[model samples]
Target: MIDWNSIAKKFKEADAILIGASNGLSITEGLHLFADNAAFERLFGDFKRKYGLGCILQGMMAGWPSEEEKWAFWTRLIHHYCGQYQPTPVMNDLKAIVGEKDYFVVTSNGEGHFELCGFDPTKIYEIEGNWFTMQCARPCHDTLYSSLEVAEKLSAAEQGGHVPTELVPRCPKCGGPMDIHMGAGQRMIPDTAAQARFQNFLKTYHGKKLVVLELGIGWHNQLIKAPMMRLVASEPNATYVTINLGEIYIADNIKEKSFGLDGRLDELLPALREACEA
Candidate 1:
């Protein structure tokens, strides 16, 4: 019962767009972190058999006996999910919706899809970091090392669920283990430059006709969702459009200016693109 035409009109009239996304958006892009479905089984069946880990997230958090084994798992994950990722239809639809509008993307997803989809890298902030980079486990410094080459090499060298001991990535400074630059407690190096860029984006669009387009953000996500809602509440001209799988929510204060489209993103995004063109 959502009005796609009305939502498209809002998108068209907006002076700037602010996008907020989370794990649900990643799911729409065929990267389900929590599900142990056919895709997960196909990609990670060996890990499940070896470690009894249920899903991608479990494999990410599971303790391994050695750094070799750990890197073996990480390399496979990075190789498949990051190195081999191609932009999906959902991403293309989103691009059509945004069109030529000035936009900034703030996402908790670490999968690096926004960059892969041809979005402006400087305008996208990955709050949980991304799969394409790694940092020292002890975080000896703030430097983030590119893991693309490392992942490829390790993935090729991996044998019997373990990479060669010499092939494991070690910090150049501390010689400690390296971990993917993600949400790994205090050890994770923060993306201060990206954070600054996002803050600047907010400042630039403060009182403009901003469209806060939230996609697949769950209720528990205070990191991205809460701040977006707050922006909508403060900016009188801001229009809030949220699309999710179920139980779409609009803040009571901004309900009058909000549109909630609840459905699968794969279906909704293409329909929305059609509506926008119409």
Candidate 2:
């Protein structure tokens, strides 16, 4: 059972908060990347029929027949997930709980929801680069460009499962095709500035009453989850609180200070928010 009162008291006492989120959190916001659900079919039926793609992740990683088709697929995703997104109840509750506290977020999600929901963008470290930005596919330069306007136009102009050849994004200097500034590896530009800021946040809060609030992170995500657990173990004053649906893990070392709540976020967050309010 969740000890709501104890968790509330911990939040009340925290001097700073660091949030770690990944795929599961995005699922709560109704964007399931791994599922070939009805919504996926509705939004991506053409791609499904042509390429036999199962889910969004497959579409992202698939090799397209041409630049026009690739841009068409990407623009549709950007227009729907980024351009039309609104802050959900979970985000609202999280914001309320963080309320003026010194806080930072590290997320593997590239959807940009934290920034859209009024969290200071500088404080969010998108470990995987976000969809709102695009970079040169050849990466001949370091600059990233905004993609929403272009995506909206391209999405509207898509025909026969492909964007117009003229609408395909290209780098200004190199004239090479552009790709989303996400984890496309060598083709993608890294958000180094954000990484520096996240490190600085950790340095500033070294041994204070820090609360590492982990949401929807899976067991295998060593990039965010493993480091967070290490931090909590190393910092005596740091407490770890994790919430996920059907999975909650607390390492033995941090078990005394860790609180793991396993359940659906839509229901859990509101209750936690009320407890924090109390």
Candidate 3:
């Protein structure tokens, strides 16, 4: 594990710090992204019996062959993760730290925690897109519409261990498919505004004395993490600080300038916040 005391000191001295959050942190705070719960198990019991699928989350992602089915699964996921879930103290602490500094966020977490915690949308780069909105599955245009009402309906219908077919979402215009902009594949459309903000952030801050604070970013999706880490490494005075449970390692190029803390963000962020404050 990296010495957080030293890491905190480095963070305090940095000009800009880009904090990143991932699904692991969300999971640590009692939100299951890909895991199954009792409710989901019951709802998917029939599907499970038919396909030998144990977890609803995994089964839905794996079993769905079409965009329409994928959207249905994501619609359900977004409804629960955004509306019903509570933000962790760690997330709150991290938000506080960023608020105190010249900071930006580049996160893969679809829960929209940073924004919910009052981070400026311009300063926050949501690479995985938000859970509160849906886009055309085909993504003919980079348009996103609010999914809050739909999410609420889906959540309500998901009671009594059943997912009502009527609650299943479809494209409003085309009557086709609508999915969360989660970057599942090439078809995944990033919100154009968010994409512009991310590019602006990169262009403005690249190769600077920045601190890249990554929390619970795993290897499952290297699309965002790898490039961001590389950007930090390219800078002469940039440092990469990663706090993750079990796995905590960085490239050798940034190793001397990096701190790898092998632990949960729920435990680490508050400590780091105190240390930074001190």
Candidate 4:
């Protein structure tokens, strides 16, 4: 359990809140990346039967048979997760805790839940890109565009787990195949403008009472986790708090100032909100 009073006190005393989130909180909010259930089977039975695919990552891999198959799968993936997006209690709880606080978020989540949950778009840095946008897959261009029109068409028109060939997205600039602007691999592109905004936030409030509230940080990409630890370690007035169900560690210097709450986010988030409110 976490010290609710201290948590509340730190939050109140902090000059600004910096949130860094990974996939654990996302799964608890229903954007499951490694889905293994009847729902996945119902939607991707053909993919499973033909390719023995067990997870969404497998389908998004480089060896997915053909562009047709790849586009079909991507359409469904974006449709279910992004096009039909819904915010969960965890997002609402976070919003409650951040209520009227000067805050900024740098998240790797591509699902755009922060915006859906009513966080200020300008204050949030979607570092990993978003599912609702597309970019040239051939590395031909750096521009990103809204995929809402295509996502809607795909959701409405895709049948038997395949999107219409005419609806398949192609880069308008080079006629190359387009990919969702998600940071899953080396080709992943980051939003430079948003990165600049985040840099400004850091520059403007460097030595203040900053609290790094990290949630569900994973081990794969060091984009969020590594930088978060470094930032907290550098600032003596900073406090680091993490809500992760698994291993959570801190350096010798930051140990006393850090807090850890090990538990499932879906169960812990609402309770955290209650504690903060009380």
User: Cα-based RMSD of the predictions, in order?
Assistant: 1.2, 1.0, 3.4, 1.9
Candidate 4 residue-wise lDDT, 1-278, digit = tens: 46888888888888898999988888787666688677678777788878888877677664655556677787777777766778787888899988787889989887888887788888889877887777888768788888767877777777765677787888899998888787335787778888898989887779999889988986454889888888998887889988887867665667888888788987777777787788
Ranking, lDDT, top scorer first? 2, 1, 4, 3
Question: Candidate 1 lDDT, tens digit per residue, 1-278?
Answer: 86888888988888999999998889988889999999888887888898898999887877778889788888888889888888899999999989999999999888788998999999999998888899988877889999878999888888888899988889999999988887356678889999999999889988889999999998667999888898999998999988889868888999999988889989998998898888
Give candidate 4's total backbone clashes.
Answer: 0
Q: What residue pairs are clashing in model 1? A: none
Off by over 4 Å in 4: 219-221
lDDT scores for all predictions?
0.88, 0.91, 0.70, 0.80
**Stretch of 10 with least lDDT, candidate 2:** 181-190
For candidate 4, the lDDT comes to 0.80
What is the Cα-based lDDT of residue 226 in candidate 4? 81
- Ranked by TM-score from best down, the candidates are 2, 1, 4, 3
Candidate 3 lDDT tens digits, 123-150: 8777767676777778666678777677
Q: Judged by TM-score relative to the true structure, which candidate is superior, 1 or 4? A: 1
